[model samples]
Target chain A: MDLDFTPGEDTFRAEARAWLAAHVPATALPSLETAEGFAAHRDWERELSGARWSVVSWPEEYGGRGASILRWLVFEEEYYAANAPGRVSQNGINLLAPTLFEHGTDEQRARILPAMASGATIWAQAWSEPEAGSDLASLRSTATRADGGWLLNGQKTWSSRAAFADRAFGLFRSDPAADRPHRGLTYLMFALDAPGVTVRPIGRLDGKPAFAELFLDDVFVPDEDIIGAPGQGWRVAMSTAGNERGLTLRSPGRFLAAADRLTALWRERADPHDTALRDRVADAVIGARAYRLFTFTNASRLAEGGDIGAESSLNKVFWSELDIRLHETALDLLGSDGELADGDDGGGWAEGYVFSLAGPIYAGTNEIQRDIIAERLLGLPKGRR
Target chain B: MRFLLDAEQTAFVRTLDQLLAAADTPAVVRAWSAGDHGPGRALWERLAGTGVFALAVPEEYDGLGPLPVELAAAFVELGRHAVPGPLAETIAVCALLRGLGDRGPAKEWLPRIASGEVLVTLAPAGSYALDADAADAVFHVVADGLALATGHGPVRASLDPARRLARPTGGEPLMSGPAVRDAVREAADWASFATAAQSLGTGLALVEQTVAYVKQRTQFGTAIGGFQAVKHQLANALLGLEFARPLLYGAAVALAGGSPGAGRDIAAAKVACGEAAYAAARTALQLHGAIGYTAEYDLSLWIGKATALRTAWGTPAECRARVLAG
Candidate 1:
């Protein structure tokens, strides 16, 4: 099969390369978990929106360039190659945005998408409760019918970006009388600052308030905030989870860029030929390249009108593991400085290493992903609960 | 950019799979290991009749064009059956002969190889020559050129009895100089690339076999496949094979397209496939428990081949170094 980009795609790459070269910040933004860093990243998102670089795959009416998946991949390559800041609006743009486009009504789409794209409303996902992390179907959150709306009552822990987010979206049991674990659930969006809502920030492994505990006590949500049909929240939320695991949420460009930095670090080290470390560095690079090719294949399939399927679980497991290995190799090469969060040389491998530890746990745990692969892809018998 | 096999390539692989299935590969492998190469030879002739042996031979040599992708596709099926021969090395030798450019030995050997009248095997500079005892000719690869073996020396048994390695003595310098050196390097890449493909094929075979076994074999009043631990282990092995398969195909494309990163890409494929296959072997044997360890069981053919191929063209460490070096 052909691996060369088309002329039009090459032109898109050139344009992306040129824009990224001119627009990437000279200095890295601070950690997005902090207030100052969050504001800075939010401003950066607005800047990207101003240039219509915020979402290249969205339709033109949704403030995107209507770029095909291949072009979007090219855009991602250039985006990460330039070492641009991570998207602070990922929850809104990557996860919830797809759901909104797929399941939201015209009124909700028109009301929420532009603001979300412009970074005027940063979104967080409230999927997991303290007792319902991997077993999301066991969530006890409820949405009781109110006057012309629903009243949400639940506590969601480990809601990423909720510490500083303006809005949150999640699934709630709308029909309490339903028997099935996943039945009668409804997906809803609500302002985090509503009257009965309270957000207590949860400190991450790096001691940053990147996630939070979201408590809702009879919080009122308008009828228009419902996404898809009530009692079909399970189906709607599955779409968002698919996006989380697919090429949209975690692009290969992120790993490619990390690989380049890791290679450079290895090349610059005193013993560039350390046998053990060299093998690992090579593995990281190979893993990254494999992932890049894999994404391109997926992009090609999508371009041919193929649906995104269970393969995203495969991608999630691979990249999350690759992230840890690349970071681990970099830390090993750093030697003494690796243990320090901030060295005199300004290295932050320690912080990154800690962050990488969460990759296998987030989105969906690797254990759950493995089960999905076995039961779905391999046609293996379902494991007993 | 498309990274998948086209319709023709897909059909080619499907046809090869059907052919291998009809060949009763397990019986052939069993016969071959008992020191009877008759069944293996018949299977080779059948494959040759299908132009499998001629894929990498040049057109002028009365064969198919030197197509690396086609060779990769063929070898994957050969590997899936754990075919008992140096097929990868033979195809690589064909490419080297075609690439030797109008030399006397090239003309003399090309036709014989294309017709499947003679078998060829190769040993890289530092590796033992596989199938040397059975091959009509052996190419002793050197850094600067190839030294053709006039006679095979003593054969040594390997962990996989189906694969026999030998020392090639009486090396007569066949080709030398820069072009030949480049040809040798390209041949090595093809060799590594084919090994990777074979590893992936064998890995898939192991997983498939284990999947069938776990579904039927009951333990503690239930099929072990229903256990979470067993399911997770098998799933992880499947992940390894699935991820590595694309890399193998991508490396095939890169080599065919003459990409600048072809060397590193091939090496990357080699390492990924090697590790993936090894992981599959481990899980298969572990899940199969005692049966997987027995030599009489058919599972040993794939398990042994997986271990042997993991270090064939290059060890995973060596392949990894090549990746980093590039």
Candidate 2:
């Protein structure tokens, strides 16, 4: 019920604010999906790792302060408010790392985490296939035994950042004849530059290679690279999916920063007579604040040893849609100039609008998130999956 | 930096919920809507026995509070039961009296209010006093001040039959000045905060009732809840309601902390929670199809109450303006 940050937390916020103010780039980097932008963001991530700010909540042995989630939240708020760089290592730090922390071996953690934290090796998700978007359990990707490793061969489409990422992780059907579609799968990580691996960058609506398709042909993945036990991929992957849908993937601070920028945009460019747009601007701010407050509550629960399960679906539906609305409000304020590629400084409102278009579709579509919320959270009768 | 309710607040909410659960609130609501306040008044006294109304009055006044968090939680339960009365108005009036500081008026009325011996309501300068005929005292709310006004006109029907509004006139200014202006603003914020909590509670009820309905009311050979279309709409409604919750509690926290920006936080909560509740009402009605339209159905009481609470303290447009102004 209390909302006051502790003195230590206040000091932490001050330290974070100072560090971000000093180190964040003077100008925004290019979109991470682009080649040059990808490299620049990787450098930014390295700098963050140098300061141990890249993963503040991880144990210190793994290059983090082992900060509490509350501290992590404060750091995020500071990071975003300072207009810091977009996280290039998020697929590793946010999605994969949590699963790793849960299921990866100590060897895996010691080896993979520091590199991932330093952005020496960026990671991408290879979960979806052309035929397995929402129904991902039905994916046809397979992995079979090899002399010293597992050989993977299948196609994974809509692999985010695979165009430039160093490695990718996904579930492979290790025992294809298992009774259930979700069973018998194994989660594995493979280097994208392996001899039998190919990445085909696909252009998004704005003609950017925001995501890519992957073709794996006997790409050798070591047995040690597997996450969790064999045939338990479904459970392990669900944890990653939970992290992706919940707090880490889209922190409330990001939206709060966007909301602030949207308000600034409105104050600068909006027509005086546009009351409708004015109300919408206000709503976007409120929505962002609500999301931030909501996440704080969830983090508090987590701090108290509570788990966020199906409720993550609610977060997925909320923040993704709120991101879209906040961006849309900015575009509405921009009016005709919203179409320009770099209208709001180098932040790229038009590009952001185009990117926000994917919010509902990614990290599992909003439709699927809604179904999860309904059946699991609300106790609604299970419908067709 | 915790945002979940404390044990005391949780216990208070649970008590209020159990009391309302056994109060036969639907019967009280129907009786009040039909212009019979006997049952509703009795329900209010029983709720008062739980120290519900006393949560708003300051501790110096033989009451437990100015405890905004506890009060908000209690009002949520009241709204969940569709309790028909000026629930927010009474709390807001107590806030206004507290904002006036140590005064004869606060001492005189605060004890009666906390004990449920009197039902007091207030009306903005041009607006109407809710439940005018039932109120023992009506405070007139001006732009920057307040008064113990009298001479209430006949009760006028609102969209909510139980929410009978009447214009109270012949004001006797009890407070005026810069401090009163701040007090007046505080009163509005409290009203809006509590109303938003009520709105959220109402929405939760609507969605819960609808969830139960869709599970049983079958069509086309299966439970309609089995349809993706129905499930998605309810999910969206639940999303709105769930996210709105933290904002409401956050506003309560801001108020408890005496933060200067509590007004802005309250307005933000008012807009978000109120809209979420209203949207839930729309979804509830649409999902229930024709059956939800009947006034006889218990759901209609919540349906009507949600809309009333939305504009009771501050309309969406006004609240949004407050938020943007900050």
Candidate 3:
């Protein structure tokens, strides 16, 4: 089997490399969880969209280059190699955009995608509630029939991006009396600043407002904002979950970049006799490379028209674990200085370490992902969820 | 870029699997372990007819390839079946001979190896080759000083009875130069790569068997596989194997492409697949409880091989150290 990139892909890589080298900011932006950083990152998104670099795999009408997955991979490697800013619009562009393309109407795509791409309207996910987490189907959020659409009423905790986002999308109980918990639900989008809506920021482990509790009371949403048919919310949302767990949400480029930095960090300041830590660093590098190759294999499979299923759980578990190991190794190499929340000595690692902690918890917890792998991918007996 | 076996290779695998499946592999393994080489040797020749051994020899040696990808696929099936003999050693010896450019030995053994007429084993970086008595030729591997063993030592016991280890007591100098060093390194990489593939296959087989066993073997009035505890363990095993797979294929690709980093990549795969297979075996034995522990049970065959594979070509620590150095 051939594993080398094609000439066209190589050319795409060159062009992306050139653009990123020229445009990437000289210094890192403040944490995206903070308001000032949020605005700054949104501006970065605009800059990327201006050049159609924000969503390379999307159609041109949606401010993308319509690049193939392999080319997108090339662009990702270039983007991370250039140390580009984290995508502030990841939720919309990576998560919501895919679903919009798959299940949303053409009108919805035209109305929502361009804005999402340009960061004119940042989107949050409002799926989990206080009671529903691994068991997401048990969410209590409800949508009642309104004069022209639906009025949402419920609390969505740990809603990513909701603290400062302009709009949000999630599942709501459209037919509460349905026989099954997953049935008769509706996926809808609504303005976050609507009359009866409220967003209460919640500080993450690193003390940043990365997530929020979204409270919707009579939050009116237009009929056009609904995605797919009423009872199809579970199916539609599950599709997005796959995207979140798979390559789009956590591309190998980020880990590759982190790996490179870890290697450089080891070379720069690590003790010569710390063979154990050195091995750890090497392992992180190997793990990152393995994930990168595995992703390209998946991209090839997808390009060849293969369907994605529970296999994303494998990707989710691996990268989430890799993220933690990488940051931890970098921290260990920095010794006590690594513990600093911020500074040039070991700056960004503490934040990275804290962020990696969320990997196993979000986009479905690792526990849940493992269960999926066993029952679905491994063809294990149907286990009690 | 395609990261999968092409149509011809896929068909090759299908044919090999059918031949292997129809053969009573367990009986052959048992017979070989009992020092009856008749069935195992016959099976080997049939496998050679499918060009399994030919993949190791150079094209000029009346063989098809040094095709790493196809070799990786073929060896995985062999491991899945838990075939007995010095398989990886034989392939590594071919690589060694090809590198030797020793006209006498190359002409004498390469064609024979490709035809499955003789089994040549190499003990490079090690003191002994498994099944040395059964092998037609055994080479004592030394950097810049390669030699053919004049005679074999008494058979030594191992943790697994199936692995019959013996050292070479005397040697006939075959080659002595710097090319031998390079050849030794390349052959070691091939051995590691093939062993890694074997470990991956054995682990996969163990996991698949465990899953089937758990599905039917009930506890608490329900199938044990339905338990989350069992499911989670099996899931972790699957994850280890699944992720290890890409590394194996990537290592194969690197070897085939002649990448300078091929040694380091193969070492990484050796660590991953070896550990994955070892972990799968542990989980299988634990999950199967008493049945897995019994030698009479077929599970012991794979379980024993999985354990040996962890330290066969290189231990995890050594592999990880290589990774660090790289």
Candidate 4:
């Protein structure tokens, strides 16, 4: 396969890079801590949307530039190179938008797509129950039939962005008479401000509440809130999960920016005499490059409307592991300062390192990705369950 | 720029795969391993006649023109077959000579290299210090000036029996100055890429052989491949190959395109391929049971080639150090 971008795509990249340089402010970049940081990150997302630069591969009607995947990749590369803030609406832009496009009704699309495109509303996923981390099908969240709608009751832990999100989409057991647990599932969406819903921030080891625990007791979801059908929650959930597993979570531009920062950091701080550390930095740079190529390949395929299948699992694992390793290399280079916290006496390597530990845990654990590769890609037999 | 292979390159890859498949089967590898150098001279002659060596050489240099990525893709198939010989080295030498703009030796040597009449190996391993007694010629690049060892005495050195390693005995100076340093570094980079490509092939072959053996060999009335431990090990070997393949291809492309990032890419590819090939070979040997330990089996030969190639251009640690230094 070829790795070179086309001339047209290169021009697009240059244009995108120029725009980012002109418009993306230095102060808008996000730190891993602080609500203000996330707010600035969201503001940048809106800025990108306003420039018609966000979601470059989305259809023109959906506020995208209707660019080719190669162009989209170029845009992403330039965006990351610009060190733009993380997209605050990434969960919606990456996961829910695709789902809505595929499964949402006309009115639903009319209402949600624009808001998502403009970054007017933030979305979060309420998927994992406390008892059903990897075993997602065992989710005990229940939804009962009610007057012209449904009443929901469940607790979703690790609900990333739940505390700040305007809305959440998740699966609920909707049919009490269904024999199979999966058969009773239904996909539902609700405002986070629904009367019976409560969001509790969960402070991670990194001392950031990037995730929350959502408790739902008789939360009302209108009939229109059901994405597909009464018994279609599993399918809808799978669609979202597939998107999450594949393209939505990954951003090549983002990692490239990190790689650039990492390279500059190493060049400035690392002693060339410490050959081992130098080598590790070299590896990190290479990994970042490879990761970008891999993502770009998949992006092109997606643009061509081709299915990525189990390969995205492999990509997810590669990038997550690479990000963790790159940050670890940074920490190693920092030596004593690596242990300092964000507000501590030293620099923020300690905080970055702590946050990096989540790379393998969030999205989906690397272990789970391996299992997917083995079972789905390699045709290996499923584990005991 | 596109990341997918263009039509011509795809066709080139298909042709290379077909040629390797027909000519470099496991049986052929077994026979070659049974013989010296792990490749028949006639087979080498056939490949040379196909202009494989001239791929990276400039057309004016009596070469097929530059196609580093094409050469890389072809090597992947060669790696798949575990074909043993110095295909990578010859191509690398052609590229190196081309980079040096010294077509005289290339014009003299490339046709012979293409015809499988002569074999050349680069001596970058002991670049810092040259032994003047063993090599027919020495190409040296340093900050002060470049020098060639001439009219030196013979010397002994330990080398992999499968491939020859010689010290400088004597030769006239080819080229010297700061300009040659770029060429020298480019040559080193090409050599690293070649080693990485060959190691990838060796590792892939090891995985294939190991997987096949595990599937056929049975324990407790069940095939060992059916065992989770066996499956996991085979999977791990496959993982190593997977992780290395893209990096190798990326480096090849970078070098082929003559990108500013070539050095870092080559270093990364060398480290990844070296580690992957070594680990895969070890696991493959371990999974082959007792037969893997025996010379009768080709696994040992593949293992030797992998080990030799891993350390041939540069050690993994050295490559990694160079990459980080950038």
B73-143: candidate 1 lDDT, tens digit per residue: 87778888898888879877876876776467777887778777887899888578988877778898766
Interface RMSD of each: 1.2, 0.9, 1.4, 3.2
Q: Would you list the C-alpha lDDT of every candidate in the order shown?
A: 0.86, 0.89, 0.89, 0.71
Cα lDDT tens digits for candidate 2, A30-107: 888799999999999999999999999999988899999989988999999999988989989999999999999999
* Candidate 1 structure lDDT: 0.86
Off by over 4 Å in 4: A1-11, A22-25, A28-40, A175-184, A300-305, A343-348, A383-385, B22-39, B99-103, B125-161, B164-182, B213-240, B286-291, B324-326
TM-score of chain B of each: 0.95, 0.97, 0.97, 0.84
Clashing pairs in 1: none
Across A276-306, the per-residue lDDT of candidate 1 in tens digits comes to 8888888889888889888878888887888
**Given the true complex, what DockQ would model 1 score?**
0.79
Q: Candidate 3 on A171-233: residue-level lDDT in tens?
A: 999998999999989999988899999899999987799999988899999899999998789
The CA lDDT at A336 in model 3 is 78
**Residue-level lDDT tens digits of model 2 in B3-43:** 89888889888988888899889999889988899998998
Query: How would the candidate models be sorted by lDDT, starting from the highest?
Result: 2, 3, 1, 4
**Candidate 1 — which residues are off by over 4 angstroms?**
A343-346, B142-144
| Reference-based TM-score, model 4 | 0.87
CA shift at A92, candidate 3, in angstroms? Answer: 0.5
On residues A1-385, what C-alpha lDDT tens digit does candidate 4 reach at each position? 5576668877888889889889978553445245777677677767888988877878887788878766766777787777666677888888888888889998988788777877778888888999988777788999899999999998999987776778998888888678876788998889999999999988878667888899999999989988898988888777777777676577666667777777787887888788777767777777776677666556656656678887777777777777788888877777777777655343445665676778777667767776666556555555442
Worst 10 residues of 2 chain B by lDDT: B141-150
Off by over 4 Å in 2: A342-347, B142-145
